[model samples]
Target: MKNVKKPIAEELDLFEKKFAENVRSRNPMLDRIMRFIIRRKGKQMRPMFVFLAAKISGTVTEATYRASSLIELLHTATLVHDDVVDDANLRRNFFSINALWKNKVAVLVGDYLLSKGLLLSLDNDDFRILKIVSTAVKEMSEGELLQMEKTRKLDIKEEVYFEIIRSKTASLLASACAAGAWSATGDEEKTRLFHSFGEKIGISFQIKDDLFDYGHDNIGKPTGIDIKEKKMTLPLIYTLQQADDSTKRRIIYIVKNHNKDKQKVNEVIELVKQSGGIAYAREKMLAYQQEAMALLHQFPESEARTAMEELVQYVTERRY
Candidate 1:
């Protein structure tokens, strides 16, 4: 990440200050929550993607800063709401907003962040960027609902799984790249290209995350959390596809009924491992990484381009 941020360090610094200011509130309670969020912020990967995409396309303008902020705001809003939906108590190893402040406050905070993002774009007349991000948000919501529906039935196929991740996870990253390119170059073609690149990267990113679920190492999140939630990931999906009739039925029954049992979840993980699902998912992730690199190479050689390549590698190679 240090290598990835080298080309856009100053821009990122300024973005942090602006982003902090953008989320400030007059209400004391809201302000406190905002401060808490800012303090425990993640790697700011989305903002880095925005600035790098902008720099590779053209220059990082003031509009680019706003684009990054808008992306972050939308990302944060979704995370807050996701915790409520998932009943998750922890985020990035810290108590989640819903856990600390309760679901009602967390929901309102998510709404506030969403409204602030919309106002930031509308007030500045950033219609193009706004449209790109709004489309992502809509797709994300759809993707999430589709995943929930599929989870109950345990009927997700490879195509449906791709659709779910593309909408739920890839859409936001795609918008970050599109919004940044449009803000910097105002070129529809370049924006489209970056959006495609970001989508591939986002898919690879989610695949890497799914792989972590089968890992035994002490990583960020507990292994098999996805299995426990009955969320069909690529590895588990592939494993089921390759299983014999009785084996497939048994696995599906375990996932649908005994998901909360640690032993059952571990059994599913072992099945994924033995069936070469991990290796298959890894191959697909690398294919997407290569495709993303090919799209990024279209921008020509520059520090920004190199940094973007490093960012792609980081996404696939990160431990957590």
Candidate 2:
């Protein structure tokens, strides 16, 4: 991930400095929590998208910094809240904020982070950036709720599944790229192009994630966690589409009743693999990947464009 962003390493460093500065607080406890979050930050992929889009479209400006930070802040807040909602005890191999500080403190910290992001945009008069991010956040919330609502019934059509992933995962990446483009040039057309590009890449990224759940591939996380949670991912969804009524019922039965049983989970995983689910998902992911690359190719050639294409490839090839 670090190497993938080498084209914008200096800009990323500046982004990091600004991100830390923005999150600092007068309150000692809040400051401590903010510091901890900064220390435990993830890949900064969203910010990378922001910077790369800025460089690709136009000059990287101070507004670009704030835009990137805004994306990161909102992303961090969502992750914090997700940990609380998922009852997760760890994040990226470290203790989660909810685990260390309790749910109440974690929720407050999440709110604080969200407020910080909003204020950053407001203080800078980055209303376009604010609008992009706010919409993405709303879409993300809707995605989660929709996925949760469908979890029990387990009847997710292919189109609805795309909508859910686009909302839940791709929306933020779309916003990051669009916000960067807007901050750079305010060229609405270019912003729209990059926005669509980000959505395609984001969808491919998530499809790859779903693929990991059925494979023995070393993706760091255990396979079948989605099954255990009764979440219907792309592979399982596609598998269900092709199955007979009885087969679908049997699979659902396993998911609903025997999800905790390792053997049953393995059996289900095997069934999905045998049913061409993995192949269908790989085809869809590749299609999205190709679409994203096609969009990238439409832009004039540059190092930034190459890096962006590499990012798309990274999404498909990443093992973890």
Candidate 3:
């Protein structure tokens, strides 16, 4: 991440200042919450994508900063709402908004952030970038609902898994790149290309996350949490696909009925490892990474382009 941020160091510093100003509120309570969110901010990868994509397409401008802030605002809002829905206590190792402020306040905070994002774009007449991100928010909602629907049934096929991730995880990243490119260059063609590139990278990112569920990584989440939640990931799907009928039945029964049982969840994880599910997922992840790199290569080589390439590699290589 250090290497990826090197080229955009100055831009990122300026963005942070501007983004801080953008999210400020006159209400003391809201202002305090906003400060808390900023202090506990994650890697800022989405804003990084926005700036890097802008630099690759054209020079970074004021619009690029707005694009980054808008994306972050929307992303943060969704995360706040997500914690309420998941009943999660933490985010990025910090107490979640819901955990700290209760669901009612957290939900209101999310709505506040979302409205701020919309007003920021609409007030500036950033119609093009707004359209791109709004579409992603819609897709994300659909993807999440689709995953929940599939989880209840535990019948997620390989294609359905891809669709869910593409919509849920990939759409926002895709829009970040697209919004950045459009903000900088106003070139529809380049914006579309970057959007596709981001989607491929996002898909690979999620696959790597799924693989973590079967590993002993200190990624802050427990092994087989996905299984415990009855979420069917690519590895588990592929593992079940290759199993004998009896084996399939046994695994499905465990996942559907015994998901909360530690011994049963471990058994399912072991089955995934023994059945080469990890290897299969890793292969697919690399394939998507290659595709994203290919699209990225279409742009002329530069410091920003190199940083973007390294960022792509970092997505699959990161420890957590």
Q: Which candidate has the top score in lDDT? A: 3
Count of backbone clashes, every candidate in sequence: 0, 0, 0
TM-scores of all predicted structures? 0.97, 0.97, 0.98
lDDT against true structure, model 1: 0.94
RMSD of candidate 2 to the true fold?
Answer: 1.3
| Clash number for candidate 1 | 0
Q: Would you list the C-alpha lDDT of every candidate in the order shown?
A: 0.94, 0.92, 0.94
lDDT of 2: 0.92
The sequence of per-residue lDDT tens digits that candidate 2 reaches over residues 160-210 is 899999999999999999999999999999999999999999999899989
What ordering of candidates by TM-score runs from best to worst? 3, 2, 1
lDDT digits (tens) for residues 216-284 of candidate 3: 345554478899989899999999999999999999999989999999999999999899998999999
Q: For model 2, what is the alpha-carbon lDDT of residue 28?
A: 99
